[model samples]
Target: MAIGGNPVFRGKNFRSAVATAPPVPQAPYGQNPYGQYGQPAGQSGYGQNPYGQNPYGQPSAQPQGQQMTPEQLDQMYKAPSAGPVETGRMTYDDVIMKTLACLGLVVLGAGVTLFVSPAASLGLMVLGAIGGLILALVNSFKREPSPALILAYAALEGLFLGGLTRIIDAFAPGAGFQAVLGTVVVAGVTLALYKSGKVRATPGLAKFFLIAIVGYLAFSLVNLGLVLFGVVDSPWGMRGIEIMGIPLGVIVGLFAVVLAAIALIFDFNSIEEGVRAGAPRRFAWTAAFGLTVTLVWLYTEILRLIAIFNSND
Candidate 1:
């Protein structure tokens, strides 16, 4: 019942139910005919009455009206049925719908920032980046998923992405579009591989992913520090350093892209497990949130990589 690898899915909310036999109901005192409370053997007050009438003084066992016909019973049986939510189970449709909702909000937020003035968009982007990061961390560590917070994170990330795209595209026109196309391609390919069983979130691969993520985070933090301290004149800090006549950013970006793809695999695996385990329908939001985080990361990395290539040209 344990969910591992994905921080967003590591809570009891996603655990599977344990099956056990139902306890047998015991009879009340003096109700048992077999000598309970001095009751006589083979003597009982109960009797089978089809009309639900008491054997004690009361109305006759037969009802006044005639019973419904088989046609009526058939009509009742043909009525529209309740859905999965009504039955209290998570379903693929639920996950897909919620995921689409989150993505839609992201697109809406991005569209707003995309058309705004540069100065205003920059300010919003800064606010969005900081806010998104906080919310993302909050949602990840939360025991239960919050729909409001997850949507908020998506909107903030969109704002950040839109502004970043605007700024980067100014320096290198069409780079943003290329990045979008690249993100789509990567996601599609990753999904294909996952569905085809060519890629999987095996334990060893998951461990490797964790190590790589930690190293990448450390490097990114150090690079950010160098850039802020004016130790690296390049906008990308050490990533702008050339190796074999190619910017180091390309290498790192490609590596990061692979990691992001693998992260998608993990997300897919978690979702599949959740569905198979009959996790609560509410956890569909968690699955959506996880996919959003990985996708945003994937898009940003592709955007940066494309931007660097354009800058070099």
Candidate 2:
């Protein structure tokens, strides 16, 4: 596991299973053909030849009527099909299904908030934001993931997002739709870049990302404080300020979008490592959670950026 990067992926679950598991010793060539307890060849507990004789008093090896062809011999040695816990480990199907489940719940919760009255929506959004924060923290620190908790987090986030989008849409009609499209574009581009090997979560880059996230969080907290204290009158607080005739948010938003995209790379790396390490199927929920967090952040940043631009115009 890569430490100090994203809280959702900072643990042993991301480590290689081969690295952690005890190694199996290989049998020496031409010795112990049965490969059990290093027993000598042609020996059994009952003094019978284990390889050539059956326990039912039947001769296991008889004179071959016809020699096997090369293709037949190759077929006989083919590997067995993989089970859920096999060396092939987690497949793309597992991650995709789990992620879709989480996203579906998010859409369900959002629907509830979107149709509700304004006052009720505001209350739900507040509750959802606080609940989502707590669940996100709990899920991040958990050693093993709980599907229920992860689903709950997604629902709460959906509620918060729904209300926020409604509020933003009231001011700027169709802004929410635009934001969704923008999120899709950004995520698609990031994923394509990742698959193309143009971006990766190298150690040096990961460390830099952690540092940048800390700085960004600190800035956000300060900006929120200023807004709450009435020090900044604009909707976006400090981000609404202009530098050289350009809104600060345009600059800050682009930086935040890039950071969110980098975070996606980290998520992808963690998922790839987890699958390669033969992590349990349940851990797919963790992968989904990490991706959801990144996607939500990306969408909100894009939504606010667009809103700021619309307001300025």
Candidate 3:
């Protein structure tokens, strides 16, 4: 099975929890495992009477002391297999619920920003951006998922996103809504493709994604430095420069959107693997956090892309 590219899924517990079934015991070749449907081994049974009673299911008259009747055994065989809840394993529903809870907190935090003054909002946004990064790193490296920390990260991210949207939308009206719509569309399409088996997280693709993400991060840090030092007058720094009549930000923003989309795919793959492998139910929070991170990345990239395009006009 493909271990996903998401960092959270690489924990030791996640890896160790997915164990293969043990091999079944085999009887000696060319010997009858069952004989005459319940006759004693020394009489008509072909198999030796080492264990006394037959371990394999042999249809026989129900003895008085037997716990299960033949009809009950038939019902047991016909019953459905245990679900994730019954088996105490992670499931898609668990991921969905946890994801929703995290996102709800994010929305609540964002909504709080609306009532605050611009100055206060800006300060809160900075606090959220710094705090969120810390929590995200802490959660990513932890051996087990921490729901409180994960939700805290989400809430902080919401504040940052809310302030960012307010600032950008002030200049480019309706850009925030457009970015949200674009993110939803992109995510929805990627999920559809994944469900159809047309898209997958392969090892080769994961390697490429890792390299690309590293390069993108390097470029972003360089750009941030340039902007902070006033080496570039434009708000986007080097990204505002034109290349062949197109703003660099537009190009880079699109590339970033693609990367975020791919990250979402990796998140989906990881969650599926965790659930299928019967990971602990609490790990659902980890999956939720991974997904929220990807979605936030996707939303930010889309927002930036829209802002760049609007600025060019």
Clashes of each: 0, 0, 0
RMSD of each: 9.1, 6.1, 5.9
The digit string of per-residue lDDT tens for model 3 on 30-140 reads 333333323344553333334445547553344433445456645644555556798778889999999999989888888878899999999889988999999989998
TM-score of each: 0.78, 0.81, 0.84
Tens-digit lDDT string for candidate 2 (221-301): 999999999999997899999999889999899999999988888888888776666666677888888888888899899
Global Cα lDDT for candidate 3: 0.81
Ranking by TM-score: 3, 2, 1
Candidate 1 — what's its lDDT? 0.79
Q: Which regions in candidate 1 have their CA more than 4 angstroms from the true location?
A: 1-5, 11-83
User: What lDDT tens digits, residue by residue, belong to model 1 across residues 146-198?
Assistant: 99999999999989998898899899999878988998899899999989999
Provide the lowest-lDDT 10-residue window in model 3. Answer: 30-39
How far out, in Å, is residue 257 in model 1? 0.4
Stronger candidate by lDDT (2 vs 3): 3
